[model samples]
Structure formats: structure tokens, C-alpha cells
Target: MRLSIIRDAFDLVTKTQNLSSSKTDEVIDQIGLEIEIALGKMHNTEPGVDCKDVLNELMRNLLRIAPLSQMEGIQNELNVPLCEYKKILEKYFNPDISKAYRNFDIDTHTLNQIISKHFYREGLFDVGDHFVSVLGEPESAAIMKSPFLEMYQMLEAMKDRNLEPALNWAATNSDKLAQSKSDIVLKLHSMQFLKILQNGSIVETIDYGRTYLSPFTSTHKDHIQMLMACLMWIGKLDQSPYKALLLPSNWERLAEELKRQFCNLLGESYNSPLSVTLAAGVQVLPTILKFTNILVKKRQSMNHLPVPIDLGCEFQFHPIFVCPVSKYPATEDNPPMFAACGDVFCKQSILMMTRNGTRVFQCPYCPLDIDAAECRQLHF
Candidate 1:
């Protein structure tokens, strides 16, 4: 009888459409129930039994029956609000605000118009530019066929001004109906990004790379756009990876600007976590240098010189350390120079790019760069 129940649960999961939400929940719940019963049977078979063996057996069975979860794809899906996400997306395909309002609030049509107008004309493009970044193109046909696309169709109704159809679609696919929500939550951490410790969001940025593991559109434009969004967000918050903020300027000025912005954001209340450690030769600078050193050391293909030990030592001894002094000039006109438009990129970065046969140096911070041929002509 127990085996029959387990088999039935398996069949239910197997028969459901890949995009169906109901089957995801049913499969998980039924598997959980069977595991509990299996464990119960083991308990009843022996008086005061050591439950470890039974528990392990139950766990194995549960693992064997668990449905495949698109963990990364699901994580990307839940990161943004549904309506706002759909609305922002319309801008990329075209400038139409009609799609933006298709799912306008049934209870607040006027409000939906206001929100759509505000975003579509004002900030939706920027939002879509950023949003498409958070979740790349769907990885599977299952995802393209999922309720997410249904949400997109509902968005289409706004373009047609068909409020009834839009609202009906939204109603049928309510937020509460996302049965895979729990499975997604298990794999992601949801802390307010702004409220984390100073370095928190920087760490969160690493997970952005993981989204690529899911099969998505493999376009260079998409990758560059996603990187730009991450850099912009970090730059706005006065965050680190100092190289990311270089604009069309000298290294000194760029470094100074970043330092100023960081100080402004950190403010007086920041209590100088670095200073306290410096007074006693124990603190923030050393820890940061260690991290950077490890990252730098791990690169196998880098052609640029390493950061000097003296600099790391200085940071260790001092309470606070800012940008490194520029030892190299800022343009291709200078031998061993690398220019990206408004600013000179790191020598190491230039060396690496050159090694890869890349010629045109587009500065990450500002829009300044000669074409590959121009840069080559300038190269000594």
C-alpha cells in the first residue's frame, strides 16, 4: 500500500506539464508524506529503535523521488516584483507603454496609468535595462511556456487596453499560486541589500555570475549590459572594486572621486572600523588587502605587475589606506600605457586585453576610446 502511494505520487509529478505550478507542489508534498509514513513504519517495527537508520532510509527515498528544480532560474524569477518587472520589460522590445499597462491594477485603473506613465516615460527603460540583467532570457522551453509568459500575455492586454482580460489573467495566476516559491527560497538569502554591512552587497554581486549557469541568451551585448548595471549600482552606493569606477580621467582623479564618494556614504558614524584596527596593528586594511591579494594571486593569466608588498604593508600599518598611486601614465601615447577613453585602465588590465589581441580600449568609467587601429597606431 505504501509503495502504491509512492508510485502514484511519482506518476503525478511525471505527468504534469513542466511549466505547471500545481504539480511542483503536489510532488513535494506527496513525497514528504511518504517519507514520514516510511519512517513511522520503521519505528513501529522495533521497540525503542535507534531511529537513525530508518531516518537515513527515508531520506534516501525522498531524495530519489524529488522532482528536478531549476534552482538558479527560479531564484532569478523571484528577485523582482511581478508587475514592475513586466512593465520594465516592454521598453526593451519597443517604446510602447501599452504593454506596460495591460496588467494595470483592476481595482485602481487610474493608479496603474499613473505608475505606467511614471515608469515608461521616466524610468522604465533604465529599469528594464537593469531588470533584464537580473534575469537573463529564460533557460528552458518550460520557462518560456511557464506562467511567467502568461504574465507577459497579461501585459499585452494593457497594450490593447483590454483591462478585463489582463486582470483575469493576473487573477488566475496570483502570487500565492507560485508553488515553487519555497523551493526557490531555500536556495537564496533575502536580506535588504542596502542594510547589510559595508561589504555586504559586494558579496551579493558574486551571485550575479551564477545566473549564467542557467542556459540563457549568449550574446556579448547582454553580458556587457549586465556588467554595466552591476558596476553602476555599486558605483552609486560608493562601493569597491576601485577599477570599476574609472571614467575618462587620470587615475588620481578617479581614485579621489571614489574615495570622496565612499567617505560621504560611510559618514562620520561609520566609526572607522579600519582606524580601530590600525591603532593596534590589527584591523580592516589588512583584511581587505588579504582578500585583494588572494584574488590577484589566483589569476593565472594576468600580465600586469603585482601590487607591491610595501603598499600592502603600508595599508597594514596605517589606520586607513586609499587608492594606490599611479606609477604608469594614462594613455596609449605613453609606452606601456593603456587608455580607455576618459581614464587609463589598470596596466594589468591593458596587458591582459592586449595579450588577448583586443585593440580598442573602451574605458569602463567614461566613454573615451580610440578604435583598435587608432589605439594600435598610438601604441609605441
Candidate 2:
């Protein structure tokens, strides 16, 4: 059904010539043409009109087709063109105009005039008048693209206490929004727009900014604007105390622990007891020391440090040192020595000397020699 209508609308748009002036008459004539095309496409050669299907098609065409024309053409002619009035009664009340009129004692001519005035003027005042008349006053008002119009309608409707039907109708057509075509005057009247900037959903901020913040307008910095909007949205939310604790110390600690656990899982000692391989011995100490420094600095920077100064800077944060490997001597009296190429080894190059040995030792990271004396433990 949608495809059929789209094809018809395309044909209509293609065949029809552009209105040079877009005068009141031309606009009205275009509306008549649209109605004719919709009727023809929904044309039934059988017993009667498929009233339900025809009505649905007509409303969809209005919602989709009409918006395209308004978007493409100049806005001045987008006013409810005159001929649109002829079909309003047909479109709105459906096949049961008598039933509708009887139900409410509403005058059809007055309604036609109201719709005509709105279609021609395309102003908030006229739109409000038409909406109030058609939907009838229990102020369920939402400005289609115009917050000011919505607010005005809402205010006008509020004067009358009976507003349920209007509210219900407004809610029903909530999705029938036009990208608000507002001038400076309309903007001046938009209070809800300001309120939403102060407090609204993330989705709403993006949507509103598309219209209000012109793409052509240059900002001092793109990132600054983006971050500012994010900050505004974040600042408005109900924050928790724990959200502030995400610091460098916490991050570094997490990384160190993860590395330690991973090495343990790989069957490697996190803190090597036997300096059997240079790689195994090198892995744990430097990483732990670096992380300790990071945590201490971060804690001090955050002003969370107390007594027992470690770094000895103005910030008195003490670092917790990891214990040295158990098998290694505590004193530098028998410290492990490395060769000239920055390879840590003791006494000799084991890999070069061994041939029939079940186990041999070497550097894991680079081509460094290892001590043979510690390699024959063979347990690991």
C-alpha cells in the first residue's frame, strides 16, 4: 500500500510543473492535485470505497508526501493551500460526517473556514485556532515543530478546564512533527527549548541542536562544543559518589594486578625465586616498581595521601613496595651481574655450553645468555 502511494506521489510530482510564484491559488491547486492522485491511487472499481484502507492511505500520504514538498519548496507557500479544505471533511470525519456532526452539533462550514485560514496563513495563531476548534479544548497541545506555538496553544487551552480530549489528540499526533520552521520571534517565545537545554535527554539534545544550532555557524572548537553538551547532559543527571574515584592509581593498580595474574596463569613465577632466565627475573620487579610509583604519585595528586612520605615531594604519599624475590640475596654484596650487552647472567653463557642437557636456559625477550647452575632444578 505504501509502495503504491509512493509511486503515485512520484508520478504526480513529476508530471506537475513547478509553481513559479507559489501564489495562494497555485498552492491550493497543488493540494487539489494531491487529493486527486490519492483518490485515484486508492481508486476502487468495485461496489464501494474501501473506506478503512482509503483513509489510512490518505493520512500516510499527507504525513509523508506533504512534508517532502514543504522541505523542497520555499516555506512561504507551505501554508494550508485553499483546496486542502475541500478534502479535510472527507479526510477527518471519514465516511461518517453526519455521525460526527450529530455527535457534536458542529457546523461543517465553520470548520472548513478554520482549516482554510490555517492552511493559507501557516501561522501559529491560525494553527492554534484550527487545533482548538477541531480537537476541542482540553488543552492537549504540543507544537508540531514550534515550541512557542505549542506553549501558546497549551496556554490558551489551559484557560478552559476541560482539556483531556485535546491532550489525548496532541499525544496521538506527537509523531507528526515538522522540523520546526521558526523565525527569531518564535525562538524568543520558546521557553521549553531553553528548559530542555538545561535539563533534557541525550537524544533530545541532539535532535533540538540540529534545528537550533545552524550547521553553517562556526564554533570556536568542534570538540569544545561537543564536550560542553556532554558535560551539560552529565551534570544534569543524578550522580553517585563512587563515580569520582576513577583515577590513575586505580587504573595502574588494575593493570599491574592483571599482568601479575596473567603471568601466574602462564606457569611463570610473578616474582622469580630462581634468577634462572633473565626474562623471568626481569618481568616482575620493574613493572611492580613502576606501578608503585604511579599509584603513589596519583594518590598524592588527588590529595588522598597521609603521612609516611615515599617520593619526598611536597605531596606526602607513601608507596607500598612489593617484596623482593625470596631466593635472591637481600644485600648487594652478592648481587646478580649482567654481561656487557645488558644481558643479566651469572658466571657463564649456559645455552652455548650445553648440548645433551634435558633443560637449557636463555633470555626470553632477547638473545641473552643464562647461568647453567640454576637450570638443573628441572622441577618446572
Candidate 3:
């Protein structure tokens, strides 16, 4: 709808320009014709015709056909449509978004540091260094350089189909990966085996498998069997039963998995912090804008927004519990408690119903009756 309005305004401007051009041409043609006829009459009548009188007559004809006042009137009339268009647009204008930040308590220095770190995480080291230096904090650049630099180097190597750096990193962090139950090392080894099968001799491929693929056989037997089968069609693996093993997507998947595991080992999220925050903000901006409009209409302070904007499951990184009976959300202090029958309620509400843990109560959402002591605190 907004685009349509803008397009209509643009079309109107174009139409006005065309009309003005056509009107100007018409006036000029009329004046030219009148002057031509007057010139012919003067030439036929006498050779010594009064030039001043002809000029005056020509000016009068030009003024009558396209007067200055008439041109001004056309311009003024064209503005009327533009003014109406402006009014139409004003009706749909959103309230000033700056009003939403009237009470923001952000620290500029902290924000700058975050931005610098975000740039560093994205492998923009020069840009990050320049920012830190401009902010007069050269010492802080040391802290930002190491982790992301190593990560970026690993990613670069993976991009070139070189898994040596990634494999080394994975091997060094084996215990952490095992604790986290990550299969990134196995996946990387599989990728290495595929690379060998593609470019190396059959003997070399078998040797590579024995060294790397054997350990993962118990956990990934089917995949190891497929890799072993690829050796049969050494010269033509694309036509083998394990043809899917030669796909470029395997390398891509391995790279992604490697990055995820690397970040996991460092206790960082798989996605960059900046990306997650931006995605969440983009998802919630519309609801926030609508709520801001409501607050304006109600003449209320926009300092606090209504709870539970519902940005959908993707943006819900953490768990939220709402009491079925009270219809109120659970907090850390008063967490949701689950009954033996699998019903959940806020601690305060359940305590009230159980008479301060001195009696039993029926599950509000089920047929099971149980003592308050049986209700366990649920954690998300």
C-alpha cells in the first residue's frame, strides 16, 4: 500500500511534466503561426513596413496565448495535487521512533567495544583495529585478536578443501568434544577419506581409512561401510553404489560442523552474537512498533512494553512457563512446579492451594490429587 502511494505520486509528477511540456509547445506553436502570418502580410503589403508595430503585435499574441499569469496558475494548480498527495501520506506516517529511546541507559564505550568485537568476529581485523585505535584503546585490540583469528584461519583452510588445521584443532580438543557429544571429528575424518578417494590411489585411500575411519566405525558403521565401498570404483566413484559420497555438499557440511564444534569448544554460540541479536530485533520490531502505537493512543508512558510479544519458536532461545490456572508467566523466584500427574503451576499459586504445604490439592489441569511435597520445581 505504501509503495502504491509512492508510485502514484511519481506518476502524477510525470504526468504534470508531460502536461506542462505539451502546453508550452502548444502556446509556442500558436505564437509562431501568428508571427508567421503577420510577417507574410507585412511582406506582401509593403517593403517599408513598421518593424516596431509588428514586434508589438507579436508580443500581444504571445501574451494572449500563454500569459505569465496563466503559467503561474498552472504551476499553482499542479501543487494542489501534490499537497493532497502529501496529506494522504501523512495519514499513514508512523510516530517518531526516537520517542522509544527516551529512557535508554546505554553506555557508549561499551557499545563501541561490542561493535569492535563484532567486526573482529566477522574477520574484519583491520577495521576492528582501526576502530579501537580511533577510540584510543590500542591495548584492547590484543584481547580481540587471538580467538577469532584462529577461527578465521581454520575457516579459510576449510574453504580451500584443506582439513589439516581443522583436524588438528579437533584432535587437540578431543576430550571437550567428547564431553559435548560432538561428532565433528568423525565427520572431518570422513571428509578426509573422501578427498583421498577422489585424488589418491586405492592403497592410499585404504590406509587413510584405517588411520582415521576405523575409530568411528562403531558409532558410524553404515557411513564407514559406504566409504569402504567407494574403494571398489576407485577410478569411477561417481558411478559407484556410494556415488553420493563424492558430492561437494559433504565438504560444505563438514566445514559447517567444524565451525560449530570449534565455537562449542570455546563456549560460544554457533552463530555470532551480533547475528542472533539482529535477527531477534528484526523479528520483534513490528510488534514493538504496534505496541508503541497503542501506548501513544492510550496516552500512557512507553517506558515499559507489554509482556509476551510472541516472536515465534525460532526467536525463543530460552524456555518460558505460563501457569495454566493463574494465566501468569513464571519467573526465577516463583518458578513453575510440576505435579505428579504432569500438571504445572507457579509456586505461589500451588502453595496457596496446598495451604502452605500442610495439605493435598487436586491438579488444576488433571484428575490426579497429590501432596504439595510431590510437586517438583521445573527448570528450563
Candidate number of the best TM-score: 3
lDDT of 3 by residue, 79-102 (tens): 877787777666545445454455
TM-score versus the correct structure, for each prediction: 0.17, 0.14, 0.65
Better candidate number, 2 or 3, judged by lDDT: 3
Candidate 2 residues lying further than 4 Å off, grouped into runs, are: 1-190, 215-380
Model 3 off-target regions past 4 Å? 1-95, 107-110, 322-329, 334-380
| lDDT of candidate 1 over 280-310, digit per residue (tens) | 3333234334444465588643233244324
- How far off is residue 252 in model 3, in Å? 2.0
Runs of candidate 1 exceeding 4 Å displacement: 1-18, 47-49, 67-88, 92-380
- What's the residue-level lDDT of 311 in candidate 3? 70
TM-score of 3: 0.65
* Tens digit of per-residue lDDT, candidate 2, span 222-250: 53254334435444433523232223353
lDDT of each: 0.40, 0.40, 0.80
Candidate 1 matches the true fold with a TM-score of 0.17
Error of 2 at 201 (Å): 1.1
